[model samples]
Each structure stands twice: as structure tokens, then as C-alpha cells.
Target: MSPWNWSDLHLRDPWWLTAWLVVGYLGLRALRRRPGAAVFYSEVSLLRLLPRTAAQRVGRLLPWLRVLALALVVLALSRPRAGQEEFRIRRQGIAILMCLDRSGSMETPMSLGDTQMTRLDAVRHAFRLFVTGGGPLGGRPDDLLGLVTFTGYAEARCPLTLDHHALLELLDGVQVARRPPGLGGPLRPASPSGLTAGGGGELPEASIPSDPYWAEERLTAIGDAIVAAVDRLKDAPAKSRVIILFSDGEQTAGVVTPAEAAQAAKNLGIRIYTIGIEPNQATLREIAEITGGRAFTAADPQALQDVYREIDQLEKNPTEGRLYTQYRELYGYALWPAVGLIVLELVLSSTRFRTLP
Candidate 1:
């Protein structure tokens, strides 16, 4: 319920208020006639001289009580709500589409503090922190974020939205791409010993191919990922549009070359910040350069988290929007009163105001 003021009060179903006309008509008709006048009295001058009893005086109120009850019922039918508050919000926000590589090569183990996890798992953890805010990252509260996963093909896992919780849920479900059973190669680990450390330790720089079947599983479609991101980010309404390309391998499968996709992104005023999980950064550096963005190589889990935090700082825009809370339902305020009045009317009509047929 709200104070009876125009600014705070809102009628949800105003059409129901039209029922008041019927109640009003009934009230006027009730006022015109005596309600319990079933028998006529003739030659009764002596009866008029007698003092009226308490029951007869109080009985006059029954018709009005019923009318009041009906009026309350009509009021209840017209649902009422109250506004809490409203304000204008101004924030520096950006739209970011994170392009993640899910190829089998991403199964390479990496160190995260005292625990060991797959490269994809490390990236997922960093991304969750980046969106929700933890440690050094302030989180993207006002920014629109999306997701794109790629192996041999690129797929948009989530659309650009302010709902980061839903985006993170989809991100959690992403797994390394797997080939069919009859495929020539198995998902062999890139490094059996796991060449990564947490506190700025030396990371594996060279792509040492120990398994002959490695090439069959490592189908990273970097170009297709960029193109997919561009398609999703081009029409964003934010002041700044960005794509974070996170991958451990070069472009091994795709129709469009990485250079062409970068050029397309540049034409559409979209920046692509490339982060290489592996040390080979030639293609990533070129892609960043073509789109007037930056590239970084994350040797370990900490480095990957740092890269995302830096990107959050680099892309900033001042955005204006209105914030309004949903209205509070006030129907119960009217509805309960209407029910009470109805019960009271029934009890009085049945006892003190009882009439003959």
C-alpha cells in the first residue's frame, strides 16, 4: 500500500472501476424506498406515536452496509499498485564478445595455484572472475557480454546481454571439442608433465609435438571465431564494441583467413584483443594490429587472468540509462477489506436487519 498520492499510486486495471457505476445506481435506488416495507399499515396514527426501538433504529444501517460492501468489491477489482522509486544511471560500459577455443588441444593441463586444471578450465575460471569481479578484476557490471566457442567451426553460445549470470552458466557448460570415434586421432595431451606454474614461473614457449595424432585433434578455427564474433558485435548499441580472442593454437581450419576477418572487424569499428594461451604470438599479434587493438601471451593461469583485467580497463565508455524498480502490488489492501465488509453485511442482514419475504 502507498500513501494516497498521485505520484506513488498506480491503477493496474482501471477498467474495473467502471463497476462503481452499478454500485452507485443501486445505492441511489436503496435510498428511495424502505427496504423492509413488506406489509402495509392503514389507520395507524397511534402506531406513529410510539418511540422507535434500538433494533429499528440500527436496522436502517443494513442497506447502506451492503452498498458499502459492494463498493469495496468494485474497488478491489480495480487492481492498485505502488511505485517504489526511479532514477537515472550513467556508467562507462562496453559490449564484449569473448571468443574461446574449445579444440582438443585446449585439454593441455595448466597450473592454477596449488591445483592443476585444463587450459579451458583455467580460462573459464578467469572469465567468471572477469564478469563477477574478484581479486584484481572489478567485474563488468554495466557492460554487455557474450560468448563464442570454436574448434573446427565457430558457434555463438550466448547472445550479447547484460545478464552475466546466464552467460556464465553457458560458459560453464563449454567443454573441449571431441572428434568422432572412427577419427584417425585420439585427444593426446600436449605436455604430459604440464609445463605451467602460478607465481610468474617459466611457461612452455615451443609447440613440442610428442603425439603423431595431435594435428588431427587440434583443429582451431581462429578465423571463423573472429568472423563469428564480428557478426555478433557489429550491431551492438554500446559506445565501444570489443572481442576477446582466447586461443592456444593458430588457424588450422577455416575458410576466411585471420587477416581478412581482422580487416572486416576494423571496418565495423570493432577492436579485437587477442590473448594467446601458448607462446606462439605471431598470428595473434597481427590480428590485434590489423584491428587497432593489442595482443598478449598468457604463460600461466595468473597471466591469463591479468590479460582479461587489463582489457576491462582498456575498453571504457560512458553510457546513460534509466533504472526503475518494479511496482509493488496493492490489490490485497483493497481485497481483504472488501471480504471483511461482505461478511459483516451478511451477519447483520441475517440477525438485526432480518426482513420478511
Candidate 2:
């Protein structure tokens, strides 16, 4: 793999080496054609008085040094390369479907930095770091990534894809189920001014769960989110399949239960990592345990980011290649020496080898 290993040297364009040979021949021919130094000395006896210094002795080799430099430059033009050795490596990657719950509870704002922000907003920022790629997470470029969102019903926001930009756009749209200005169990959507609720507004009677016309289908459906996540990751080609569930509340709607979904996930060899974001019920832990996966809890923005980082560490793809190749460029070996020799030759010619016009 070393470019300096002469035995492993290879020229990409062997034809360029012809330039080196031609330069060498021309250098010798020029030496033969050049006449001996001539001076209009009145007598040869006067030359004996001049001392032959070390610089003058070294100047005699300047022409040879220039010729060698030119030859090396020609060698560099051929673009030499080093040996390429391939070795086998085993790489591992997992197909992950991020199942996020956008229930109303996510509207709970906590201190993200100097200011307060909603859990959903914080989760979105964490998602951006884990998916769009920032530090530590480096992103899952090799693995296929997908998004599944849920509140009362689960929606596949983006199918498993390598295109992170499109996925990020979908994540950006995921909003917490703000109580539609009615119920007190969960906060409603953020008002234009801020996420805080109206001026001590009383819960309207019609909006209660007991109300016959009330739509229960719009509550947190953790089970259904798991189901959708499983559906998204079932067909992935990666050896390892994972689902990261982010939820804020217990399941209120959805045909299948989280337990039932967990069984299905276990059968399909999919690991479900559950993340509870300011959760109301500890349901995520139960689901994670059932599915043979770990559960994480994030109470704030920084914690949510840290949870993502931990998951990133746990689920990232393993080294996948059985064979690999390494190469080094050797042009520097020739090019640098040529440059040094050229400089030395120029310095010698200007100093010790100076001639009168």
C-alpha cells in the first residue's frame, strides 16, 4: 500500500516514460555538442592563479542535476500508483423506520436552551440531527431510513429511503395534536402568539370523551404507530431491522394493540426501540420489552437529542465489506525530488557557474 515501495510501483500511462528516456538521450547529445569553455586569455599560465573552490567543484555537476530533475519530472507525468490490496470485511447496517407520535402532549414546552420549546419541536430538531446528519450520528447514509408518524392514527410520512432531504421535509410537517381549543387532558395547538392556551378557557362539555359525537380516533395511538413502523421495515433488505417509537401519550385509538404489534415485530426479527417524550403512560417500556428492544425516556430537548445519539450508537450498521482496496499516489515521490533538484541546479548555475556575457 505504500507508494514509496519501488517493487509495487505502477505507471498509469507507461507511454509517458518515453519522455524521460528521450530527455536523457538529448542531455547526453547536448553535452557532446557543447564546445569547451573558451576565454580570450593572453596566456594559459594566468589560469593557474585562480583557486578551485568547493562551490566551483560542485557547479560541474549542475548540468547533470538539471538533466536528472527533468527525467524525474517526466517520470511524474506518467502518474505512478501503488499496489492495491483487497481484504474482506463484514459490514452491518440496519433498516430503520422512525415511528414518532405527534400526540397533543408533545406541545408541552420545556427549556430547550435559553427559551422554552415544545416537545414536538425538540423532537424535530433531534430528528434533523439524527437523520439529516450532524455530529456523532454522522447520519445513516448507507442504511435505508423511513418515517412513520402517529397521533390517533398512524401515517407513513416517508417510506424507507436514502434521500434524507425529502424525509426531513416530512418530519418538519409533523405537528403535535394540540387540543382543538377544547379538552384539558392534552394541550391544544399553539396559538399564533405562543403555544400557551387561551385566557383560562373552560373545557367545553361537548369535547369530553363521554360526548357521543367526540372523535376518539384523534388521540395518541402508540400501538398503531408500532404497527405502521413494522409494516414499513418488514420488507427492508438489511439484516437488521429497527423501529424507533417516539410518543407522548398512551394509546387511545387504533385497531391493533401495542402488545400485538410487538409480537408481530418479534416474529419478523425487528427490534423496536421506544422513546417516550414527556409521556403520560409508561406504555413505551412495555412495548419495547415485548419486542426484545430497549426503551428510552426524554424529558427535555437536550435529553431527546441525547436519546437519539444513544440510539444512533446502538443501531448503526456494522462494517459490511468482505473485500476492500487501498491505494496511494506515487507522483509526489518523483515530483518533489525533481523540484528540489531543479532549485539546486538553478542556485549552483547562478552562483558558482556564473559566466561573462
Candidate 3:
């Protein structure tokens, strides 16, 4: 909620107010210094003989009444106005696309106090804290969330939607696996041990391979992931769109380079915030500069979580909001009061208040 006003009621026009004071001073001087000349000499005894009634009292007050009327008229002429305005904000929930690197490199184990957790695991924890728990920091729950996962290729795991629970569910299901076969026979099994000849006796349960392809895949197509997220948000409503890219300092395979993808997002009016888990300053700088967003290097899970929380803070409260206001002087007739004061002064001098010659 916000408020605006055109003219502040508390503010006064110094120039006009000064003029009023000057007029009052002049009136006082004329009454005190030339009281004999300003009023015609007459006898109050004549009025006392004529009548003793309410009219005589009313007549006596005319001079003071005129002075008060003149003061009010001066006040009105100053163009005093009190204005108030209010805003009716339509809360347009934000549209956010979270691009996560799912390359095998993301599996590197990092120490969590005495315990060790993979990069992917730490990200999941932070992500959970952001969604179901609250903002990765303390962001509002009403913001829309989307998801993108990339390894050798990029995939839109979730579209822009307000269903954060569903989005988190999709994120939780993410896992590092070999890139799907590219225009070839059925995806090659992750291991040869999984293949066995069918036998009259059911082949011994395909023995699990001892070597589970622990080496991180050689490709991380971060650029493609950003491009995909941007494309998905193209048709979104005219609200601020943001992309939070989480990666471990690598981009080996993609049709577009990271710079090109950042340009595309910039052209589409989307802000990209890059969070690099790796300690590569050069790479982090490039990503941050290209996307016109800040670069954050997280050496550990706590830092990583903090980065996400900061982004949430930025999201909930935008830098600026709409404003509109108007101001008008209600009425302007200060001269009327001055005129009334003159009339009262005249009547008082001609009647009961007149002095004896």
C-alpha cells in the first residue's frame, strides 16, 4: 500500500502569509496612531438616549468582527489546500525460471560440517528451504517458479507456474545421468553389466556394475538451458521476469555460447542472476557481466543458500512502484474578508462606537 499527495496541508505560503501580517500591522497602526482622524467625532450620549438593546452591543462588536473577517479572508486567499491520494496495487506475482546444472560435476561431494553432501544434494536442500520451507532467504511463497535442467543438453523440467510444490517435486526428481542418446538406437544402458542373455533360468539378476561411471560427464551446456528458459517465458504476462542460473563453472557443449544466451535474455527483458558454485572468478565474471546480473561464488552450502535467499529478497520487493497524484487550491477569495472588515469598520464608526465631536 502506498500514498501520495499533491499539496501538503501543513505547508503555508510564506509570501502571502507575510502580506497578511503586514496588513494586520498596518490596521493596528492606523487604529492606534490616528484614531482621531479615522473615526468621525460624534457623541456616544446620543446613542445611549436612542436605545439600550442587543442591536447596540452588535454594533459595538462590528470593528472587531471586521478585523477577524479580514484575517479569515487573507487565509483563504493564500490558496490553502489539503490533498490526499492512495494507491491500489494489483499484486502481480513474479515469474521466475530457475536453471540448474545437472552435469555429473555437480555430484562432487563437499563437507557439511562433519558430514559430506554432494553439490546436487546441497542445492536440493537450499531449494527445499526456498520453496516448501519459505524463500531460500525469506521470499514470499506466492511467487511463481519454473525449472530447467541441463547437462549435455537442456530440458525444461517445469513451465512458469504458481504451483511451487509441483515445481519442487520435479526438482527433487532431477538426477545426473548420461546424456540421452542423440538420434541413435535405444539409449545405451549406463552399464554393460545390466545386459544379460535371456536363459531358460532367468538370467541371474543383471549384476550391478562395481564402477558406476563416477567420472563427471565432460559436457555442461549452461547456455542452452538459459535459452530454453527464456523461450518458455516469452509469452508470460507483462511482469518482471527473472532467471536464476546455478552452475559449477562449466559450459562445454551447446549450440549457443553463454554470452549469446545472456544477450537473448537481455533482449527479452529478463534479468539473469548467476550463482557459480565453483571458485572460477573469470567464469563467474563473464556470466555476471553478460547477463547484467550480480555474480556470486559459493565456496560451500551455506554461502550457496545465502545467495538464493538474497535473490528472494530482491524478488519480493521491487525497486520501484507506480505513483500518481494531483493538487488544486479549493477556493480563492481572500479579498472578500478584507472587504467585510472594511464594511464592519465603517458601520462601527457611524453608529454606537462613534466618538463625540
Candidate 4:
């Protein structure tokens, strides 16, 4: 906020200003026209020959002091307040579910802006910008944001919540779904060591790599992700329910098809925004059209941000405001000066400046 200029001060009762002018006129008139008592004498010039007393000289000016005090009293009656104009916002936020793909393909890097980042990295980074704010999508603090991640199957990572900071913490921990064989992660065992512990006592090298993985986790399940997101949002408190799905691969797993999921979302009045990275746009577009939503294709990170920017605009909820204006009472400003001026008048009127009969 900038400093308040003179224009920012508004008189709440401007009609009182007419009273101010009236009082000023009356006070000035009394000061100028009030006459002193004088005795008419044939030799009045001889009276002037007498030296003027200190009290008489000072006493003559005290009427003007009273007039000045009255003028100040008039000013204080007209309340002056500091006024500000702005949108006083109290957001009734939308409920949104972020459907993210963490399949192995996301590990592949793509060029974006001046840096090269993995698809998953780009998506996560862009989304963090969207959530915490500082990008095209200002932020979603008002919105309850949830997260759903998919690989071979979909999992709800977070429930719909207005606590975006906690959501971002969860987002930071997300990694590509499956670490391929020979690479060690939660799913796969560490690289096979030459030593073995089975045969009675002495260890022997393993003949075959332990089963590549317990389950195939690299496959994409687009339909399952969408369904999961919709399920979470179906009972959300807000009327503006939305699902934003970010994926790099087409459906390779899950019992439901993307088309069927889109129809279910449509029936529930949930809008789904689909972002596909270097994939068949036809499927995404079809899903979007069915759900009364839009499909965006992001070739690079910059393109991805633009797509989200567009979604930010489309998904915006009508913001309602409850205005809050803080007013510093300028009455004190006038009141103090008025008080000081009146004190001065009282002091002078009682001192050497005192009037005498």
C-alpha cells in the first residue's frame, strides 16, 4: 500500500462542512465587528495621550484567539477519515485433485526454458509453482488440493485439503513409479553381490538375478487415475470440483477405460483437465470433450506451464469479497490541534492578557 495522499482523506459528513463555513463566517464577523465601550468626551484626543498598559495591548488580541478556537471546533466536528479503495476478497475456494503419472517413462528428460529436466521433474516443478504461487496460476490457497499418483495402479496420495504446504511436501517426495532391474529402490532389491548365504555355511554367487520385480510397475493406468481423482472429488464440499491429470503415456493397465471414466466424471459434474506429454492427443482430446473440459498438449516444460496457465483461467471460481477498510481517525489530528489552540487562548486570557473592566 502506498502512503495516503491528501485526496485519500474524505470527510464522512461533507454536509457538516457547510456548518464549518457558517461558523467561520460568524466567528470572523464577530472578531472584526465587536466594538469596545468608549466614553464620548469633548477632549477625547487627551485620552489617547495616556500610555497604553501591557494588559490592554495584549487584551485587544484575545477576541481573535477566541475566534480561532471556535473555527477549530467547527473543523473537528467534520469527521475526516483516511479512505482506501480495493477488492476486499474472502475466497470461497474450489476443490481440486491433481492426478499425476509417476510411471517409468517420466524419468526421460525434456528441454524446457533454459534447462533440461525430466518429464516428472518438469511437471512437479510446474505444479509446485502453481500451488505455492509465483507463476501464471497465482495459487490455490483457497482451494482444497488433493493428489493422486498412478503407475500400474492408482493411489490417493493426499486427501482434499486447504493445507497446500503439506501437499507440496508430499509432492516433493514423489518419484518415478518403478526403478528398473539392476537399479535399487523401494520395489527392487539392491544390485546382486557376488557373495551368497544359502549353502550350509560358505556363501556362493547367485546363478540368476532375483526375480526382476514382484510386480510390473512401469505401466500407465490413465483410467484408474481419473477414476480415483473423481471418486475423491465426488463428495467434496465445494461445487466447483475439478481433476487435473498429467500423464506421458496412454493407458496400459487398469480395468476401466479412459472413455468410461470420462463419462462417469461427466455424470458427477466433475471437470477433468488432461495434459499429455508427447503422446497421442486424440485420446486426451476425446476424454476432454466427453467431460466438458479441455485437453492440452505440452511438448516442453514451457508449454506445460502455458497449459496450466490456461487451466488456471478456466477453473477460476467467482471470488466474493467482504470489504475491510481500516480508518485512522483524523478527528484526533484536528482534535489535538484544536485542544492546543484552546489551551493557548485560555492561558493568555488568564495571564497578563486578562481583560479588565
Per lDDT, the best of the predicted structures is: 1
Candidate 3 Cα deviation (angstroms), residue 208: 21
The digit string of per-residue lDDT tens for model 2 on 247-322 reads 7766666789888989999999999888885554568888888888888888888988899899888875788565
TM-score of each: 0.58, 0.60, 0.53, 0.64
Candidate 3: tens digits of C-alpha lDDT, residues 232-326: 88778747888888888566667888888888988888888888865674655676687677788787888888887877666673434556544
Each candidate: RMSD: 9.0, 10.7, 11.6, 8.7
Candidate 1 residue-wise lDDT, 1-357, digit = tens: 344456777787899989889999999888887656677888678988999999888877767777887887777778787777667778977899999998876888999789998999999999999999999888889899999998757889999999999999999999886554543433333322333223333333334334434433456678889999999998898878999999887776778889999999999999999999666669999999999999999978989898888987887657678877668777888778877877887998887678888
Best by TM-score: 4
Name the TM-score of candidate 4.
0.64
lDDT of 2: 0.76
Tens digits of per-residue lDDT for model 4, 1-357: 557778788877766667667767867786678556555567777877999997777677776676676666666788888877666877788998999998777888899767889998889888887787774578777899999999868999999998888998898889886544564333321212322223243222343334434233655678888899999999999979988988877776777889999999999999888999765757788788999998899989888888878888898867787766766557777777778877888998788665444
Worst 10 residues of 2 by lDDT: 187-196
lDDT of 3 at 16: 63
Q: Quote the positional error of residue 218 for candidate 2 in Å.
A: 3.5
Comparing 2 with 4 on TM-score, the higher-scoring candidate is 4
* Cand. 1 TM to true fold: 0.58
